[model samples]
Target: MGQLSRLAGTVRPGGRTARVRAAVLEATQDELVEHGFHGLTMDQVAARAGVGKTTVYRRWGSRAGLVVDLMNELANQSMPHADTGGIEGDLRANALSVLGALTDGRLGATFQAVVAAATCDEQAAEALRAFHLRRLEEWVGVVDLAVKRGELPEGTHAAEMIRAISAPLYYRLVVTREPVTPAVAERSVVRTLAAARAGAFVEPVE
Candidate 1:
C-alpha cells in the first residue's frame, strides 16, 4: 500500500481523525447527491462538515481527491460476503446483501453520484474501477470454493459468473431507475447459478 500523508496536526488522535473523516465523507456524499461532481467544492464540504475550508483543502488536495477518499471509505465499510457452507445459500446471501445495499437510499444515491462523476473525471473513474475490482475479487472467492466442491463445473470463471449476477442490478440502478429488491437479487442468483450448473460459464477447452 502507498503511504498516505496525514494533514499535519489537523487530525487529532484518539478517534478524532476518524470522527472528522466520517463527517467529511457524509458531507461529500450530500454535496455529490445534491450539487453533483462539478458543483462539489471544498467550501461546501467544509460548511457541511463544520470544519475550516483550509482543513478540508489541506487534507484532500482537491474535490476529486476528497471524493476518492470517500469512495475508499465506503468500499471499506461494505458488508462482508456470506459463507453459508453451501454454494447456493452463499450466493443467495451475497446477492441479497448487495441488493439490500443498492436499495439503501443513502448508499444508492451516493453510488449514483460517484458513477456520474466517474464518467467525466479520470481520477474518479480509476477509484470506481478499483472499488469494483475489489468487490469482484470477493465474490469470485465464493465461486472458486463452489467449483472446488463440484457445485460448479471445473474451470468455471468465478469473476465472469459473479459479474453476470451483478450486472442486472447495476443496470436497474443506472438505466431503469428501478428498485433492486431482494426478489430481484434472488432471481439473479438463481438464474446465474442455473446457467453455471448447465456449463454455460465453464472455460472452453483449447
Candidate 2:
C-alpha cells in the first residue's frame, strides 16, 4: 500500500484518543500560523496544547508529522456542499462558503500563510494538495447534481468547474491581496456557471 494508506491505518480509533489528537492538531495549526513552518517547534505546540513534549513526540513523531495530521484534520472539517436544487443556487452557495472560509477571522490568515509556505516546502505542498482535493470533491457533488438535473451539459467536468469557481478567489487572496468578499464569490460562481452552460468545459473527442 501507499504512504497515505499506511498513515490512514495508523490513525487511532475512538473517543479520548481522537479528542487529544484533535486538540494537538488545533494547537499546531495556531502555532504554524503565528510562526511560519520554519519557526514552528514541537515544544511550542506542546506548550500551547497544555500537553507534554513527550506526549506530542510519542503521538506525532515530528513537526512535519504534526503538520500533516493538522492538514488532514482541516480537510476532514471542511464544509460540505449545499444542494440548493439548481446549478446557480448550488454554485452561489458553494462560492459563498469558500469566501466565508477564506475571510474567517481565525482561519483566513492562517490558511493564506500556510498556502504561501507550501509553495516552498514539499511536505506542506502535499498536505495543501490533500486539503484542496477534499474541497474539490465537495464542489464536484454540486456539479454532479446539476448534471443530473439537466442544468449542465453532458460530460461536463465538475472538478474543473470547481477550480474555475475558486481560481479568482485564491488569486485575489494570494496575488491581488484583496478581500474575498461575497460579491466577488457570487460573480465568480455566476461566470463559471455561465461558461459551463455555454459548453466552455466540454471535453474534446478522443
Candidate 3:
C-alpha cells in the first residue's frame, strides 16, 4: 500500500491544507458522479478544483489516490453508530443510514461508479473494500453494545452482524437491480436481527 493510502484516515488537515483537500475531493466526487470512474482524470479533478495539475499529481499521485481520500472523507462525514438503547432500534438506524446513502443522487452515483470500476480494476476493488470495511468497523460497535446488553449471543461476530444488516439492502440495490428504499432497509434489519438473536452469527469454537 502507498503511504498516502495507508495514512489517508489519520492525516488531519487545517487552514489552507484543509481547503485544498476539500476542493480536490469535491471535484473528484463531481467527476465520478458525472463521468464514472473510467472517465475520471487527475487533470480534470485539478482543473475542477482550481489547483495546479502538478500539485494534484504530486499530492494525490493517481486517480485511485483521489478515490481513497474521497472515500475517507465520506466515511468521516458519516454519522456515528446509533445508540437507541435497544438492538432493534440501533439496527434500524444503521439500515436507514445505508438507505439514505444509497438513495442520495450524488453519493449513490459516486458509489455506483466505484463499484463498476472495481469489477475491472484491482486498485478500485481495494479502495471499495477499504471504504466499506471502515464503515462496517464503525457501526459494528452497536452490535458490541447489544451483545453486552444480552440482546445477542455472547459470541456474536459484531462485524458480520453489521454486515448482515446492510448486505440485503446492497444486494437489492446492486445485485437484483431493485430499488433500495426504506422498506428494503427495514426488512434487512428485521431479518438480520432475527438470525443474530438465534445465534447464527456466533463464532464457532475451533
Candidate 4:
C-alpha cells in the first residue's frame, strides 16, 4: 500500500476522476493484501470499488496495470524525501520510513505479493522496477545535498546509497523472514552510513 502510494503520480485536489482513482486504488490494495497478486482480478477490484468492470479494464488494462497505477497514486501521496541537514540524520530518516512501510501489515503484504509476482511475471517485475526507480529518484536528492555540503564524496552515487539503506530491511522482511523491527532499521542506518561516509558509494572513474 505504501509502496504503491509512493509510486503514484500527482492527483488533482478533488474531482470525480480523483475520487474514482482513490476508490479503485484502495480496492486494489485490499485485494493485493487479501488475495496476493495471483488472486487479484479486474472483476474483483471493480466490484470492490463499485465501478464497472469495463471501466476498470479500460482504465488499468490488467491486474499488473492496476498495481502499477496504485503504486503511482501511493507515490504521489508520499512525503518528500527527508532533509535533516546532516547526511547521517537524513539517512536515518530514510531508513525509518522504509522500516515503517515494511512493518505495516497491509503495505508489507502488498510489497511481498508484488515481490513474489515479480519472480515469475515480467509485467510484475517491470512494475516493481519502475516504482522503486521513482522512489530512488525522489530520495537521492538527500545524498546529493550531502555531497554538495562535503559530507559525502563528490562522486558518491546517491541513489545507490539510499538503496543500501533499505536493502537489509527488505532482506530481513522478505528473504530471511526475520522480524523487521526498529532495531533492524537502526542497524541498516549504522551500516550503510558508515560505509557511505567512508566513500564506499563514490563512483569509480570512467
Q: Tell me the whole-model lDDT of each prediction, alpha carbons only.
A: 0.79, 0.77, 0.83, 0.83
Worst 10 residues of 1 by lDDT: 1-10
Off by over 4 Å in 1: 1-15
Candidate 3, residues 50-82, lDDT tens digits: the string is: 999999999999998898878877776777788
Error of 2 at 178 (Å): 1.2
Model 2 Cα shift for residue 6 (angstroms): 28
**How many clashing pairs per prediction, in order?**
0, 0, 0, 14
How many clashes does the backbone of model 3 have? 0
- Tell me the tens digit of each residue's lDDT in model 1 across 122-143: 9999888887787777678889
Pick the TM-score winner: 4
User: TM-score of the candidate numbered 1?
Assistant: 0.88
lDDT by residue for model 4 over 7-32, one digit each (tens)? 22444577777767877888898999
TM-score of 2: 0.88
What would you estimate as the lDDT of candidate 3?
0.83
Which of candidates 1 and 3 reaches a greater lDDT? 3
